[model samples]
Target chain A: MSRTFYCRGQTGQQLLLGAYGALCRQVGLGRVKMFPRTEMLDLVVAGGRARGIVTRNLVTGIVEAHTADAVVLAAGGYANVFFLSTNARGANATSIWRSYRRGAGFANPCFIQVHPTCIPRSGDFQAKLTLISEALRNDGRVWVPKRRGDTRSPDAVPENERDYFLERMYPGYGNLAPRDLASRAAKRVCDHGCGVGPGGRGVYLDLTAAVAGLGEKVLCERYGNLFEIYERISGENPLHTPMRIYPAPHYTMGGLWVDYGLQSTIPGLFVLGEANFSDHGANRLGASALMQGLADGYFIIPYTLGEYFGGAALGEVSPSDRPFVEAAKEVEDRLARILAVQGKRTVDSFHRKLGAILWEHCGIIRNAAGLGAAVEKIRLLRAEFWENVLVPGDAADLNQELEKAGRVADYLELGELMCRDALAREESCGCHFREEFQTACGEALRDDRRFGHVAVWEHAEQEREPVRHVEPLTFETIIPAERSYK
Target chain B: MKFTLFIWRQRNRGDRGRFVKYELNDADPGMSFLEMLDFLNQRLIERGEEPVAFEHDCREGICGCCGMVVNGFPHGPEKGTTVCQLYLRHFQEGAHIHIEPWRSRVFPVIKDLVVDRSVLDRMMRAGGFISVPTGSAPEANTVPVPKEAAEVAMDAAACIGCGACVAACPNGAAALFVSARLGHLGLLPQGQPERERRAKAMIRRMDREGFGACGNHRECEAVCPKRISIRFIARANRDFLKAFFVHPGKA
Candidate 1:
């Protein structure tokens, strides 16, 4: 018999949807069984080996445990912890918490990338909009008001009146400074009130001259979709007007600590794609995320798995095994406890409140004082979340509220860990910028003396501090130097 | 500005899709076509109706998740622009835009505006790789590929796999997608061992996926978001014909 595969809903759905379609065409759709919107509640641990997985099918309201030789978690990273992340709707930091609570090792959940350019938040209610890529910065110029407190639009300022800060600062790379630096620069200007857009939260990315000089055809060729996206969100035309762009938490460079083989500290469980922290050291280069994901799935994992299986001498373990049953029962009991709770606050309400606190305290810029306050705030919020949180639906159905509640519960824990990690790493390197660690020139200072290792956190008991495992990075090719575009 | 949108709506693979029209008034010139549609869907949801389903992830021009025929162009009239990159500012005040899913036998419509392009993935599986073993990161300058050659290969590697080439093609040929991978790997020394075999295997897989034969319409090159040249198609054809002679068994 063929081995059964365990995967989550959204991420798993996209992968299996493609994989099944390809496999079915090769060996008929009759041979494939796809399960979506299902929960992988527990991994059956049998004699230091992963035997099977227990899952609850949301569509059919059936709880089933499937036996498999190996389990792969392409679940994704903990981006939802940051209130301002640009991750998809379904993914939450809770998944990471559940995995850890069930004894999965995770790494660097705090090394999140605040994409240097995104459409700034329009209203308090707006969650997060789409990000325009860094590629636009190659051609489009970044500018702000020359005056320290000017809040005028691009049309009001003549060419000489505007200050193209990036160009003046770095002539070589200019506006295309690696994401971390660029994001900081935008924040600095916005905080000074020279920011454009509705809330003075963005700077102008002008392509009006580029459009006129290169012509619409050439401009469209370079950035058509980006132009469309800008128009859609901001109601502006790049062909005539400048686009208001700012940074938001986009991709997480930090994830479950995995080796070159994409295997985590846990033996049987494998993390691939964006879930595993590899390739990208501190900051990811342009157009590399897709490369890493496809490379991990299609090229890397298959060979690594073959080598692993060959060495392990693994045999089939049935789903009826004792450990599988126990794990499944544990999941069921947890769900029952959550469902039994009758509370007043809705899941969305708690999540929104959590997001607000996180964004205010932990987002963009962070210092020890802010992080300490955030930790206390998060602890208090988590307590209220457990006590007053209302989940309107049952686990058996497509309960959006239940899903959000579970994810928010995870976010509360993950947010605390993020602050702890941020607090511990005294140096500002790449995306992780602590206000206390920056230079007088507004550049991130790297303290290679004390903190140049990957921070891997081992999950401890509730209210107990997690153990930290340090993996010292040895760079053979690129020597550690102050990254200066100037 | 106000405009009329002609969108393609197909329920499933067997269902025949046609252009359905909707009107919008005082639209922002800054909004993308998809964003405009998103606004329309938000309205539809408020009225207790099913929103139009579309495939999009990472709205930045990278992920290759979103693709469709917009105003008879693969990524609209924009050159080197993907659908996700197209801004509404390029359009007139009262334009009538026609939109449709990629018309290809290999890529069938899954739902409204979403098409299955896993056939491209199948082609990649057939060969498009370096066959390097796992473990240890290679030194950056170890390969010593000339900057020119590396740049060309990188350019080819930039193909987003959006299938706009197929959407733009009259025959719905996936040559642009196939040739891009072929050229990307084939240009490198790491791809030397399986050079002939890779070309033969990938082309065969491309044919097996039910994509039409390349007829040199040059539409694929025209609409490519990265502006991958047609020279790659010729390179792929040359390699394919050469492989037919050298590796008959593999072909």
Candidate 2:
């Protein structure tokens, strides 16, 4: 597996470069027209099918209509809704949410993957978090102070007293365990005051033995960029300091719900990559995110799209068509509304406050009471957001504030639905851990009879009132059992 | 902890940018440079003013979408740091910082502090690739690359396409970015078949895009966020020269 997939620490980048290179090649050959920095604003639906889109040329600030036979959304994830996430800064849920408003279903959105090993958030000013890839766990052993709130240097913490918790609990997998399992273990220990670092929410991922076994140069060859990123962020070299890591919102498994062929609830509207909730039920496995993205783009979309095109192309529509104009007007009107407010609070201020609520209630741990409470709070926040979001700039130009306000507006709505979904599920499974549904031994207890179904949510006008349609899970071969890392 | 920042401000692509000073009273020292901008932007909204626009994504420095000239240095004062990772801790208590966008004719200003980087993508479009069709490639281990060669390829592959090299270069050259891509693919066995063709096509495209030739000024490596060395430029020089002599003679 190491030789087959690992392209050092840059596998994702390498694969993307290959794909981007191919796309760029098509652009150069005049085979595929590339809109360099255009961002999608809304979907144009006609005759109960998605026919085109409204896009803003980010450079020129021109909103244009692009009528197409199909609208494919590979527009990343919603992890950025969590202020301190390991997603690209521009990655947002606006595109998916717009499609949802145009009548698409969002599925399992509460199943957000929290990474076990991320550079701990330094302060309130952090724009985005960096992920120390799980591959480093192949050599590094995770540990913390056996005694809670120990302040001594790591060198002084004796080996006998040190709690290598991952190694202690799961002898076989240890630090190399799956993402959700590792994140839960770290959180569990931290909850007990055994966590290290400034906020006492971090555990040490030590690499002493790894450096000894495989020379520093070898590791440098493989993970030099990651190590450098760590040092730059934390101001501590991993060669000496055990990396202080805490769980962070890395990926969101839930997205616009799609069928087996990768078509969304809307006809002619396709979804892929992290945008579509297709593969990796509940939690994703290591190396699978990139695999899924590449597979969807190269294999699945081509075949499925070909099949769709074989049926019929959309009716002839121009930029001034009724559907295109209506979609364009909808986008322009929203932007105008955001600008007209001229209210007190910034979009980010409201966003930060909303993030704290969701993180405290719906994040990591959830319960009926907490989830229900979060939904109510989200409603108030959403109301305040529209009334006082303070989107300063007008819609006449390229306003960064306008763009963010729109994304945050969508997040405020999506946040409520996520909590409602969490509240609906009575059983704990995968990354969706409801506190009331846990077993006596502290493992996630699944209720296969009642809760074994995908809760597909249709967006309703009012917050906390999304209509849910259940798609029950049917296991073909593997039987459901306890997940015992021990 | 507060400071005065002279940020570059432009209303639109056509608007001429100028330094607009603002007093940033609120901040956390731990925030990355972009986070500092986020703080300032939040304040700008409170003041009923438009926030300065800058290009950024994947603030962890992987995407190469973010760039700025800070205090006369590309990506701030820190070495091997993108503007996104440059923390406030590196600055003094009351530092008066000058922030500007990348200065290049080819990469024109789109808005305040944001430039059109479509040219770099165009350079990549010219040739930066292996010609293998999807799903037709053999087993990964089929091509046995020596460890040293693989390591070198990884080192060269670390370029994020950030265009810092072009911004920092006195001649506004994109040689470093092109060389890094060239070095990454040209060293590997899989990239050998189209090495000559790749070199010619990419070089021609860079010239056509109006990027200046490499003037051997090492400012590119000095200000590069990824700290990619200029050795790849030397490698690209060799590839281009060899391709020159061989292209017409081959047929």
Candidate 3:
């Protein structure tokens, strides 16, 4: 079959709406049931197999147990745990977290890809960061002023005085360098005090050269929506000014460990998209997210799920089944416990504090000291969250706070696991960078012999540490080697 | 920087809501409109009060998750801005902002600022999509859409489904949103096969959803965050007319 990279930039939204449209059509066809304002609260495992799910209606806050022959978690990534990510506000780790707790192995929990081109953070109250698509790099030459605090307009920063860092370092790729390399490069420049914008936390993705070369009209034809979005957020016209971008949390390469059939270790439990840790080894390339999501949803799941449903030794599940009853009670008790605390700090406050620990200690650059410190800090914060996090709303109505409380509670647990995953790797590979293991010239040094295994963490008892399992990555036809653009 | 925000507070679809005035002070001018709400919510939660339940996700204006009328404007005074994209700086210091939900009969209030806009989703299912099932397509480039047509399709395609159009439209018509889907697919050869079916099915579904007829007030275009034009409405009307005259099966 022939292949091509074709989309109008908003491919995910288009394809999702299309799939959603089809799903809605199925509802019309009486072939599918619709659940719009509902959220998966927990997984219901019966007879040592995945049987059903516990769900909460976001509108009424009514917790109900729905038994499925097989449960598929299409719930998205945990990037929102960062508190200021490019993820949707409602995106959380609760579904996957519950599944992990129910014995689905959480693989490579530390593998988060911070996208390079995003509008820089403005203030503390900023809920989410916006992304300037990767296409901007095609026309935008990334650079920082040679002098610290230059305070000169991008055009005024004379060519020699301006350091086109990407070109100077990775000359072959330059502006088109991959996401991970570009993100770290941008971070390196900013840490040195030469970054642009309000807090000096941005690098210039200057389209001046592109506009000059291809003419502004052509650039506008290609990137008008993106340029307009940049201008809308920053109040700076990119036709005249440069778009300031920084790396922000975009995708998590780590998720539920799925086997060859896209089913988790637990039978009848299937995971897809960003929820499952499959394909895209350290970093994800652009636009494949849409393709993979569509392919899995439209193609793979139908065939695989059919095979499972057809041949599996499954029994009709009742709401009174041990796992169903226990899971539902656990959710109810947890919510009751959170309300019982009556703490003073808002969920957002604790989330922000937790985010700071992870970002500062376990972000792009990581070392033994930082990772160890993060693990301890997350544990303490998680305790404080249960004791002092204030959730004001009752669990009866459409209470956003109550909803957030549940998600944040899961994040506290998931965030700690992420730090542990980061610490255990002990070598830099893909987006997982260990400060102690890098080359003298500073690129990710892969210790393939020791760490070329998918670190799968299984849940232990409440107080005990989670056990880690290794799935060694054995390449059949390809050989892993040093990645260099020079 | 301070503002008196009179937010409509409803317990549920059953509750008759009223405006509760909140005085927010020391609000950073840089915070987005939703962030200011977050500030209020944090304060409320600390005070043992139920924080305002508003609809929002992807707070970056694209997801169609956020919907509210701010001070008589659908997304506040900012032109071509969703409520999520509206910054606090746009309002003068100490201004009184009236925040309300989309007050259409079809889009009943869920709690406070959130209303059920799933009607649009239902209407789309009726025929908004091309008949092309997933993996049933030839290679994407094989269709070979004309550049100008694709551009127009994208322009119409830019509707974020925020329902600001319905709130802004005096007739409560969803023509702009409905037409965008029609125009987007109709302009492409891939959409040609299902053109009449789409127009017939979607229009029937929109009417069933109880939206008023388009009086062509053009209010929807005025408040569109993507600045989607009403030209697509005319294109949709043409498709509807053609479908009425000649059913593909009858012809």
Candidate 4:
């Protein structure tokens, strides 16, 4: 049903470079003026329409306002909310979160993708997890010890004793099963005390069978770079033994809700790429994020944006407008307040704690009780973060701590919203696998009749619960079918 | 494992930077270099001292936002590893690691280990991309490209624009970086329309940005996290010379 075009293991890199080249050409022509090292603090909405944005000059720490007739945001996803995700350290929900607060509807906050293949967290000091390409699943067979708490070396574990869970559970797909399914399966096995490696958190991705069949040279040629990277970080060569991998937050399917026109609730405000929750209904297919992003930028936006412009009338808007000034001031005061909190805990400490709270309750498999507990814990954590977090730096300079503090504060709020959304969506569907709603085989059970609508949450005032609004999904030609690999 | 760290601390671009020493007693061998830095920063923040400001994104080494000098190596002593991907096990226990920002006149230190590598972005803007029409997907096989050319283009496109080449260069030259950008687009048939203009503008912008001439020291390739070859520099020079002969008026 799907086809993939790739250049070795560097598909994402090649595609990004191609896009970057085009952007640079425009920049060279003086058509695009880039503001590097700048962070968007707030979205400016004047006259009930999106107009501009307030950004902090990261170099000088100056809060500046930039107004435009139309604003297009493609600021990426918020997988970093987990603290130890496969996302960049700088990746945050700030831009989209600020937009949500400024009237954009955030849809499906709980629909986050947990990638099956990632380097397992080594220690408490581990900052972020690295993702191994899904291509490894083609040859690498995922397995764990047949006995619970088996401490023997991976190679020492006899072939018969190794329980190949993926192949056992989903014989049709095996290791190549969908990310959400595989991730959930791994968690299920680990929860049952059958996990391998450190702290019983990982499973063996054994490629010995494939290597023996294909030869070491062929295996090396296929995934040489990945193998090297694995060895570099874990200090364990995959060729010698099986690789230890665990599920980690890789992407967020939830983002600022946008319509067919790629425009959010606010007029003149367009969202694209992963920033907009337009594509990938519940789970994302492999290599599709890039394709969707390219389509949004290169095709969809060109037409839809023009259509938006054609419909709207000309309004004289300037960066010195009242809305821009107020937004800029708001950003500045928030920064000042964050700096004023000269408390004990570091931003990283709070972020790590928040990550733990979410990962424990709202991660992989969630239940109503745990989600409720998570929401309460996050609320308390957010309050503690505001009052007790130490951001030791001035607002008038390039302060990474201040940036992180603001982002973490936003994540604290977003984390609660995620729990709330997850709690509301009672039935299991795709990545949102509720413990109470799964089938006998522990597969996601979708409640189409009652919960087939897209859960869109609108931001309410401080200390008030967000208003949940739904848009019913109507299937016309193609009927929604239950996914089964077995 | 215990290790002493000498970290560069700069308040801002105008501030004079100094090396601050701190002893870390609980650095795990499993922790990445950046994780170790994060551990140190957490300690500093808890002590009411400002944490080090470093630019890091996509710790997987593809984003190219993280680059620093560690023990006189661009990304530590590793052959082709970024600071984010470099692990503590690679270093000896109780080693006094000297960490600093990328040393380049063009890339002024903003605060601590964070440097203004926007110059590289500027160079990219000059002539890095192929100008294409934005619309629906173009039909594949319309313009046939040589298999070899496509492969070479991919190799050139692997540059993360981390500015490590400039930082490691003895003359602070961005020849390797610029050439990688040039080679990525120039080898493609789609890039042929504005190829000459791209080469001239990008090379001129590189010189204008105060980047020194390549001294053939091969330092950039040696320190590059992506292991981008210096051969791309030669490829860029060939394109530059052709552009120079073709468009003498622009020169």
Candidate 5:
């Protein structure tokens, strides 16, 4: 009766609900209750199995323990921990990793995906920028000012003066150089002052020609919403003008290490959807996140859980077992400590600081010195955060502030692991680009010899560094080679 | 360029919301409507006033998050566009723009402009997916669907679920959303096993959710953020009719 399913809102919840409904219908069970944005502190470990979960309900200010035969963690990935993210509010990488680290689970805290095409920087106060999908690159063209010092308006610039670099470099894929390559190329151009937009941080994604040639109806059929989004963000009509876009940290392809059964190293503890590092190896393809999330929830978890539960004698063992009760108390204690702090710095303040370091150092083009500096800075910030940080409201009620503090607390620790992961992996591959590993053509040079394996970090005691476990990636279909856009 | 905006300001669904005007000077023609609102918000923040709240995500038009009535159109003056992508260039300098949230019974206005579209999610929950239990990753090619069918399914899958079609329709019908789901599942072999039951269950759930019946205004197709075709609606109707006879008990 106490089996708890913890998942993110919107897509993840829908997937789980659908699966739950199907399973309940098939097995003749009672109705299922859904909780949104709740935090799981730890798994109740009794007899070496995940007996239940100790969780805090974010909506109503109650700290209740749910003892279940099993706990499903589908809370999503840590893209929100980065200074600039394409993710929503709850997905702070550091906090989620720390929560698992507190328990017995492997957190691959470093596998973040920086989406190549997002609306470029608009202002400093902008918390999170919007993403324009890579699918647009299929038909749309990416261009920048040919002249190094040119700062002309998109309309003012002549066609000859604009450099269609993606088209020039890759005759076949053109603007579609997968997400990673396209993003790097855009960054390279912008770094060279060919960047468009007000901050000079983005390039122009021109579809004027496409619109004119395809006619409004055909073009509208394809990219109508994108056009609307562009207008909403940039305040310009794309029917006549080109859109300004750049890359931002969108999705995290990495997370808690899960096996084929979607179970992490911990027994009776399962991770699904974006929370588990299952699908989308290094960089995720467009429209794949939804597919992967639904796939895990609807198609993957139900089958796997049945096998797990069958071994546990179905509903014979409930979460109310002793291990679950003990774990629930520990979670309550952790929440009490957070509320006890009552410090000064807001959660947003700490998160913003953490995000800035990650974005500047561990983001896009990272170097060893930058990564090292990031770790030192993050450690200093963590010290200040724990001491001076403030939670504005009580944990009860619809407290967004309390929820943010909890998520950010994890980000602080997770940020350190990200820098460490970046530091450990010296080779440039996929979204993880190190300045040290580039060819003469300025393309990423993958050092497959030492860095091809997935770095799964085992949680160590506080103040002690975590141990690294490498899961060797064996490519079956696609050969690992220099990813050439040209 | 300077322009005036007439925006709908509603506290909640029950309250009668009206148009509020604001002026913007030195605005770029290329800036999106949301960006203009962002600019307006920046000014409001400086003045220590609360800014207008609106819903949006995945500016690429894939997430089905943002939608609004702009200048009497679901997206804006520009046909087939979402509110996020409509730029100011379409408007004449000094012209007035009207902005409002999608009007429908199912989508109750939550704040100034945001509406609770969880009704659509509820409908999907009724029976939007196949009865495949989660386990191993099936080879994508395991189903052996024809390339043409897959492409058709992919087209239907492009629906972002922004609810623009419902907003645009005079009847407040969710035919576009329903049709997109129907089309996606109907064409695929993976969806074959539960086709009739799914059709009946989804329609019954849609009716249960208090969404108005489709009136064939075709406005849903016109304002769809994805420009999802009306053909899907036809396909849905055909499937529903077939399911009604084939699985009468489910209906």
Candidate 6:
């Protein structure tokens, strides 16, 4: 059996505060200067190394440059490219996307993790989906109505008529199945018109049996906050009725390619946390992300960074240098281009369209035909975005629309690249599930001999196809084994 | 659902902000407050108008990046709920909602509903953490903490640092916010050595940042999205009083 640690339902939040406290202490000691209310637009590479970054002040909207010895991007992942992901509203791929454009190798862009137990999207106007902690799966039984198109409430459905799908499919793991498998199973059932909740796009996560077995008091001690959150959002009590959950893009295992020292393909550019495509392979176990982030930030980077600083032959750099000035100008021009569009459709309208295309074709499952069509559709949509996307705000102000427009523009390109990556990988391995390459029982068929390598893509110039590079994997310690839940 | 929103609008930090009236006729009941605002902004953008600028990161309410006052309530009328989690269903159809930024002298408006909350970070920087060696993860059970103490610390640690407490306080005091951190660190065994230091330094920084002293109005406790009790403030005050005699100015 595996074990995990948590702080109730707020582990992520508590960990963030701890990290923020450490950062603030450094800021207080004058060791670190935090540039809050500022968004990075581009990475500054001088003499073939990352020297600084260009940022637009979110308050003033003025593009400026800051030079540094070694730039570390803890900028986070691009799961937001899916648009209705569990990521923050401001969470975008702009930082890493710009870095990719500047020569960082983006590895496995298609390996996006869709969490199984997220609060289902209520409507098209939903800003972001909330994730119900996976830990609840230990106590909650996942189910759906056996009868298709059954509109009865969860409590009203008879026990025999209910289909405990996870328990039936993978009897060994039951509700505790891995995220990718669980998410796909939920999708498969929903596709068969067996989904519960709103728009018939969710399954029931019933904790009633667990609560009855372990008493409400015991359950409350463990998941009180989560239950409260569920009630507040969906207006249904999990203790009284089962929670309706659906799969939503929660994390990305694909990011900037890094070596053993966490340095990206670009020298002097260190990537950390979810931003780097290190640690978690294609599918991540729950609570491991926190461990990986803490390990990188607290344990690993310090020594590696010290070694880098000690070994590198560096020169004095200034903000007025050619690279810095050029990067700033590039950022300014992009912002201006977005603002100058002044088209009929809103930036969000384009984002929603892009999200729909990605979700339908390149989501939990993928096929060559659908992916190829998606590529063509995205190309057309991106061109239209440049031509007709309305960004009605001044470039030199705290304009939310302008900020969104810039991020969406990057996503438009990145979304196409993600589809391209998905199309190129023919094997059904990890989260990149190619429908044509799966087993008879719907399990992902891994082709280790043919596809056991990281598909790293290099950004080509505009309107040109990106070149793909492979880093072959060699297992030295252990033999590769098939993952089975049966 | 439809509603008339009076949202604060400011071009930049220097502009005198004013509430701009917007009629959102097609807001769905299932939309969160932020999503409703997004719909409003989308319409405004289509109309060739600059959208209202509000700060939001995680719309799931954990990030503390989203904050705005709604109809005189800090995070709307929902108890222990952030504005991002507040749904349109909570409001009456065609409700006239007044949205504004956190009103505090220290938290000056950057633009519209976005305020500069760096002061809270400044106060935390004074002393919000326990000093530990930066290295590999330490062995578990090295320091056994009391169960009750850990529980209290966890409760205090739930603070999201959204500054709603400061915005809700009648005196514009950050006692609740500061006290939550103080209690979170102070109640732990690892936090013992610097306990007195933390209280004095954080309270001193609070005073230095031009925050008013708590007057026991309990307005802060009323609007805290996490429902952090004001009892943490009492604990912090006790620590601060003791800190005055123990470690006076060094921290």
Candidate 2 chain B weakest ten by summed lDDT: B242-251
**Which portions of model 6 miss their true places by more than 4 Å?**
A1-6, B136-140, B248-251
- Against the true structure, candidate 2 has what lDDT? 0.84
For model 5, the stretches where C-alpha displacement exceeds 4 angstroms are: A1-42, A56-58, A88-99, A103-108, A125-127, A133-143, A154-178, A205-232, A235-243, A278-346, A386-393, A437-453, A469-486, B1-251
- Order of quality (TM-score): 6, 4, 3, 2, 5, 1
Provide the clashing-pair count of each candidate structure. Answer: 17, 1, 0, 2, 40, 0
Error of 1 at A292 (Å): 2.2
The regions of model 1 sitting more than 4 angstroms off are A1-33, A93-96, A476-478, B1-251
What tier of docking accuracy does candidate 5 attain? incorrect
DockQ, per model, reads: 0.07, 0.71, 0.68, 0.79, 0.13, 0.77
Best by lDDT: 6
Query: Which ranking of candidates, highest DockQ first?
Result: 4, 6, 2, 3, 5, 1
Most accurate candidate by DockQ: 4
- State each model's CA lDDT, in order: 0.72, 0.84, 0.86, 0.88, 0.73, 0.88
Positional deviation of residue A399's Cα in model 4 after best superposition, in angstroms: 0.5
What's the C-alpha lDDT at position B66 in model 5?
Answer: 69
Tens digit of per-residue lDDT, candidate 5, span A1-486: 111111111234344444544553444323455454366656565566666666676545566666667778777777888756777644554334644565545544565777777888666546567766555665578999899868778889898988998888777778876777777788888888888876678888888887878887876766655566666667778778888888888888878778888887777888887888878777777668888876777677889999998887534455566666666666666666676776655566688889999988988888999999999999999988878766544555444455667678778888898899889988887788889989998778888778778888877886898888898888899878877656
User: In candidate 2, what are the lDDT values of residues B50-143, reduced to their tens digit?
Assistant: 7888888888777898899999998988998889988887889888999998988888887889888888888888889887766677877988
Across A1-486, the per-residue lDDT of candidate 2 in tens digits comes to 131223545778877887787787777778889887778989988888889999887555688889888989999889888777888878889899999988999998888998888988777666677888777787788999999999888878999999998888788777777778788889989999999888888999998778888989987866777788888788888877789999989888899989877899999999999998878778777768888887898789989998888886667778888889988988888878888887788888888888888888877878999988998899899988888768765666777778888889989988888898899888988888889989897778899999878889997774447799988889999988888877
Which of the two, 1 or 5, has more lDDT? 5
User: Interface RMSD of candidate 1?
Assistant: 8.3
DockQ of 4: 0.79
RMSD per candidate (Å) reads 8.9, 2.4, 2.4, 1.9, 7.6, 1.7
lDDT accuracy of residue A8 in candidate 4: 51
lDDT by residue for model 6 (A341-448), tens: 877988888888899999999999999999999999999999999999888768777778888888999999999999999998888888889999988998998889
Docking quality (DockQ) of candidate 6: 0.77
